[model samples]
Target: MLGKLLKHEFKETWKLPVLVCVLVFAVFLATYWYLGNIPPAASEDEISMAAMMAFLLFTIAVICGNFALLIYLAVRFYKNLYTDEGYLMHTLPVTPRSLILSKLILSSSWMILISFEIFFTIFPVMERFFQLLSTDPQISLYTALGEYISISEFVLLVVVSVIISSISSMLTIYASISLGQLFGKHKVLASVLCYIGFSAITQIITSIFMTPYMVSYVITLDTTTAAAASFQFWEFFRTILWIGVGISAILAVLCYILTEYIMKKCLNLD
Candidate 1:
């Protein structure tokens, strides 16, 4: 039953994310083209500077596509399971847990796919882009990044961050939309408010608790030695990264339970 739900959900949701991925790759190709055509004196030209700004916007667009995908799916969840259609859906033999699991798994999978997409889509162009501006012959992405951390560590960080953040985000959205079920009218507005409230709360948590601790660790690092400072800074960065990951995991679980409990208690077919 879970397998069937996953397949159905994927078929329904795949088109938009797939289209977003295609558009991201299209933007990447344009970036690659611009990088390949740069003349030695191009950096001096105002037109080239404008093009660089456009390139950065293109990279930002690639990332924004991920958010857009999540937003669309969030809406889909609310409409399918909490709106007029939900009565039929709830009548199905599938358990609510399985239904939620299917959506979570698919959302996380697409996010991971697009995370790697953004990384690889931009990675090949990074070396060329930096080399065009950098004076050092030894300047490569690996060497530049190696100053702070090893290439392996950076990759691991990206992967871990992607996985944890995606799941956390999906569960948050699910929980927020689920919360709307408790409201009698203007459920959509209620969901939006719930999402905003959750965002604010999480921001407060990081601002008040996690970020200060991370900043304190970085500020306390020994400054006499440049090498040691870099190591310690990134080490603290990783420490904060894991702490954030733990918080996200906790948030995800809480949201999951919140969603299930709300569905069981307050779900209204009327």
Candidate 2:
């Protein structure tokens, strides 16, 4: 039953994600073609300027496209599960948990997919820019990545963080929309307000909890104390990563419970 719900949800929601990816890929290819053709005889300064401008434009497009996709997903979730269409959803022979899980899984998958698409799509442009700088054109992506940290650990951390963050974000929106259902009128407006309120509260709580550790970490690096002291950067980063994961996991669970309770017990379909 859960599988069927997921299949249906994916089928309905895939079009937008696919469309966004296609458009982003098209832009990336066009930009790459235009920029990669710059003649070697062009002044180095001029080439540098053009490369920077092209990178900026490509980055802006990717960011905007990703944000638009997220907004579309959130709107779809609200419309499909909270609007008049919800009348059909609630009547389906499925548990509230299953339905919510289906949406969560699909939304998180799309978010992760879009994130990867944005990264890989722009990678060629970045590679070309590096080449123009007379840097090692043979540099592997992993070699560039190694300058930061252990690639495997960092990649794992990133994947986990993205998944958890996506789930947390979608669940927050779901919970907000569920709360808005309590209103008898202007439910969409109410949902928007709830989302803002929830985001503010979450931000405040996160700042209170995470700011100290982050500040301490920054101070250590800024003063060069980390080098003098027996500080392990990887250990510190891993701790922070796990802390964030824990917080996101807890929030995701709470939002899931809230959404499930509302849909099952207090759904306002009128």
Candidate 3:
């Protein structure tokens, strides 16, 4: 049942992400081809530096465009989840658990895919740019990725961040809409009000608790110079792991309960 639900959800949500991927690829190809044949008057190192800077600028532009598309996708998903379509959606043979599961899984999966698409989409442009500047047979063609930064950890962080952030955002929307629908004859306004209310409550709670919580976590870590020198990468991961996982679990359960409540108790399809 969850699988079937996800299949339909994927069908509905895939278009925008796929189109973004295509556009990113096209941009990369165009940049690569244009820069490849254009001989620069500058020395090899200068040309390399210029090409790298150009790639960075282009990347920033693409990321900004990707963010806009992400906003559109989020709005579309929210509308599909909240409006009359949800009535028809909930009427299916599947339970609320399955429906919620589908949305979470599908949306999270796309988030991960988008993360990868962003990486691979830029690789060709970068690769070609590097090749154009390579002048020596001794100089290996493989890019010095490590020189910039340790990308493995960064990549994992990005993937987890995207999935967690997307799901969390969706949960807020679902909870707001659910709370809103409880008010008769003012469902839309109710939703907006609920969202604002939720935001205020969240901010208050976070403000009151965030500092103490972070301080406590910091205290547990080694403060001594010796311990500080011995700090491990896993330490950072462990610190954030529980918080991220806990928030994910909390939001998942909240989305489920609120969605179920809305479906069973408050939903009035027009």
Candidate 4:
């Protein structure tokens, strides 16, 4: 049952992300071709000029493309949340838990795809732009690629952080709507206001708690001696990273549970 639910969820969620990823790749390839085709000029500064133009174009593509993709994803999510289609969803033979799990899984997968599209597909092009700007040819693209790959651990951690953040954001919206609809009237306005208020409060609390750990981490990012003393820099980072991953996983589970509760208890589509 869960497998069937997931199949449908993935089918529903896939098209937009795949399209966005493909568009980003196409833009990148076009930009790469444009850069490669530029004629030799008196000053190699022309290379930098071409690279800068490509960078700007790629940035615009990312911004506009990601915005459209996210908007589509959000519209689809909300539309599926409340409608006759949602009624069919609710009446599925599978339990509400399976339904919520399916959505959560789909959401997380899409977020991962978005991250991969942004980083893997786009960053290499930006790296090429940077490579063109650099002085030494022996300071080759391989060097840049190696440096980027060496920090893959940090990149993966950051990706996980982003996925968790996105899940939390969507869960908060879900919770706000659930809370609002519990009221008989003014549900939309109430939801908006509650979302704002809750977000403010949550941000304040999170800042207070995270500040110390963040300060310590920032200090560690700089502490070459400390990095050498115990674990290597990567190992030191990994220790903190596993802790973060654990917290993120726990929060994701709780968010899914919260969404499921709302779907089963407070959601009123009629």
Best by lDDT: 1
Candidate 3 colliding pairs: none
Model 1, total clashes:
0
Better of 1 and 3 by lDDT: 1
lDDT (Cα, tens digit) per residue for candidate 1, span 2-90: 99999899998999989988988888888878776774234433245644665687778886897898888888888889777787789
TM-scores across all candidates?
Answer: 0.89, 0.83, 0.60, 0.72
Candidate 3 per-residue C-alpha lDDT over 1-270 given as tens digits, one digit per residue, 9 for 90 to 100: 888887778777788877776777677777777767666435555565667666887688688657766566546545665676766776788876676667767665665566677766666676666666766424432334433335685566656766666676666766777777677778778877887886676556545545665676566767566545235324454445545545555665776688777766776655
Error of 4 at 248 (Å): 4.5
Q: After superposition, how far is residue 69 of candidate 1 from its true place, in Å?
A: 0.7
Which candidate, 2 or 4, would have the higher lDDT against the true structure?
Answer: 2
Which regions in candidate 3 have their CA more than 4 angstroms from the true location?
Answer: 28-84, 119-156, 185-193, 196-249
Off by over 4 Å in 4: 37-50, 140-152, 155-159, 162-173, 183-202, 213-250
lDDT (C-alpha, whole model) for all candidates? 0.81, 0.81, 0.65, 0.66
Question: Candidate 1 local accuracy as lDDT?
Answer: 0.81
Question: Which tens-of-lDDT digit does each residue in 1-270 have in candidate 2?
Answer: 999998889888899899888888888997788678754324435456776777789889899888998899889888888778888998999999998999989998888888878777777887776666554457565565575567788778878888888889889989998999899999888988998998888777767777778787767654456443434455566777778787888888988899999988997788
Runs of candidate 1 with Cα error greater than 4 angstroms are 40-51, 225-228
What TM-score number comes out for model 1? 0.89
Find the candidate with the highest TM-score and give its number.
1
Worst 10 residues of 3 by lDDT: 140-149
Worst 10 residues of 2 by lDDT: 38-47
In angstroms, give how far residue 247 of model 1 lies from its true place: 0.9
